[model samples]
Target: MVTIALDPTPYHSTHSLLEFPDVAARAGYDALQLTPHPDFGPFFRYPKADDALVRNLKKRAADAGVRIPAILPVQRLAWPDETRRRAAVRNFRRIIELAVQLEVPVINTEFSGRPDELQEDSEAAFYTTMEELLPIIEREGIRVNIDPHPDDFVEDGLDAWRVIRALNSDSIGFVYVASHTFHYGDRATSLIPELGARLGAVYAADTFDHNRSHGLRYITNPPGNAVRVHQHLRIGDGDVDWGELFGTLAASGYFERDDALVVSNVFGEDETADETSRFQLDRIRQLVDEARSAD
Candidate 1:
């Protein structure tokens, strides 16, 4: 049974951290993926969760009949600067501890390196940090999945997978965010199969191909700026091909895995989050069923 979790970012502003499970339940999700939140784990900051808070959160999720399959904490594990890189490593240790306490097996995150800086430097820093963290990840039995986010040191899917593979640890895996399809070289058909079992999670959100219309879909203030733009629009609202994406996933034996995770992470329609979430759930299930049936 593939778990379809909800990313409760749309309710971050309107609801409290403790209310996320209930919010997900109300939106028709039995599982929720915890993202960075001010009260819990803020982005690029040391986690703020304590023992009491972790206990409370676990109980809340249980009460709401929601299972927290994963947590996302965006620490700069690949910072080129020594000071920032060390700080990110420290932050990651705490994040791992939190994951253990919550009994969440997966930590989905980004390769938070500087794209403006030297990619080699960032990659070196990343490996250095991983040297210290991989042992702990293995000891704790937690899977840390990395996404090659837009504007990150390695945004191309194959390149990012290569970086992950270089770590040579089964504890490290890949996160395929659908919204980043274009940035990932739009190679889901090939990428998913290449990733194989190393693909730990899939985030379902639609995004416009910036490469479309001769790269005129979005215009920046300064021409050829370093800005990389993408949207987390509802599925089918943008350019991601659901049939092809899901079909590839099925062909790669993803749907047969017990730990398979597909997250509904549409962040552009917060005004209609409840309705959009329900729609996403149904649509995702429909796509998965259609793909599986065809397979």
Candidate 2:
């Protein structure tokens, strides 16, 4: 079974951590993929989420009758500088501790790469940081998932998969974001089925083809510069091949059993929070249900 969870980025700007659970509940979400948002006080930098703060958040979720199945902490662990690298490792340790306290089963994040450092060096830095955190991660028994975020060093999902494969840990997995299909390259259609059980989660949203002239529909003033441009739009609002995505997911055996997580990360413009949340959650549930039935 697939559980449709909400990524509360849409309300990050306006809602507090204490208040977002109620918002998610009103939107009919039973679980949340808690992303680090500025309004979340100490949780914005999860390492700063002290014991008391973690307990408070746990209580808040319990009060709202929602479960926090996962937590996403934004940390740049690929920095080449020794001080920054060490700090990043330390922060990750604290984050794992917070995850233990919150009882969050999965922890996910991007493989942040240093801007000026060579790719090889950044990759090595990431590995080193993870090596440092491995002790804590192993001790706590928390699962880790990673995404190839557009601005990160490994922006391509296939490349991210390569890195994850290199790590070769059973507890580590990939998160395929639909909006990132283009950057991940042409093989996503094939890659989806190949991932099978290794694909631990899906961040479902739609995106325009950012390669063709339609990609030029929106532009930044300083032309030709590298800019991260993409929206986590509602399913049908953009060009995502929903049928193919869902079908491939179904064929991959994702919905054959329980504990599969499909999160609605839709956020672009001014959308009524409740409506957007309900629409995404319902659409995903319906698609997963139909796919399972077809199988």
Candidate 3:
């Protein structure tokens, strides 16, 4: 069955990481996707998480009866600084080691850098970092999934697909974050088939179309900047076409109903998290069930 994972962003900022598994289990998630935030320990630091903390986190997940399928370290791959990019590569190597210890199969990351920097410089840095980590990734037998993020050097789905193709490794794959639909393309469903088999994981959530002109829909002070804004809302609360998206997901040979990494990421800066997480989880289960029945 497709694994419904709970990302700690829903609670880690306000609550303790130690308490996440139990809440996620109660909410009916089968797996955990650990997200590193500054409020918690320095898990995202270049030195990586200490062994004791990693062991403790694994223990908590086991005790609560959920699996941690992946770990997401907020490392900037496209950073232009030479020294900074080297440090990021070093940290990613350590994260791979930690993943082996924690029995996590995948490590998720983003193509990150100063949005205003030269695109060529950022892309070159990212390629350099990945080339360094290639041997380590192969030896450790871990999968790496990358996503196009808002304001990153590569923010479009097709560009992200090109990066994944250029990597040309079986272990490297693309992640489709539904909340970024508008940022990535005008049509989310259409982009999925284009990525096709290269699409490895999905971060599930709903978001309103940022291009819409309704003044009451959203507000940002001091206008006339290039900033684009969106939120991860529960299903049906936003404008995503869930049915068409799910249908395309099913048609993609890379995505299997029996086993796919689908993370419920309905996180917000000023919203009650647990309730929203539970709501998203239930909605995802229902959708999966419907998809399977149709299949």
Q: Which candidate would rank higher by TM-score, 2 or 3?
A: 2
- What is the lDDT for 243 in model 2? 78
Q: For residues 70-115, what per-residue lDDT tens digits would candidate 3 score against the true structure?
A: 8787776779988778778877877888889988888888887656
- Segments of candidate 1 deviating more than 4 angstroms: none
Instruction: Provide C-alpha RMSD values for all models, in order.
Output: 0.6, 2.1, 2.3
Among residues 3 or more apart in sequence or in different chains, the pairs in candidate 2 whose N, CA or C atoms overlap within 3 Å are 1-257
- Stronger candidate by TM-score (1 vs 3): 1
TM-score list, all predictions: 0.99, 0.92, 0.91
- Lowest lDDT 10-mer window, candidate 1? 217-226
Please provide, for model 1 over 1-295, each residue's C-alpha lDDT reduced to its tens digit, 9 standing for 90 to 100: 9999999999999999999999999988999999999988999999998999999999999999999999999999999999999999999999999999999999999989989999999999999999999999999999999999999999999999999999998899999999998999999999999999999999999999999999998888889888999999999899999899999999999999999999999999999999999999999999999999999
- Measured by TM-score, the strongest candidate is 1
Q: For candidate 2, which ten residues in a row score worst on lDDT?
A: 39-48
> How many clashing pairs per prediction, in order?
0, 1, 0
lDDT of 1 at 30: 98
Residue-level lDDT tens digits of model 2 in 198-232: 78788888887677685684587688877777778
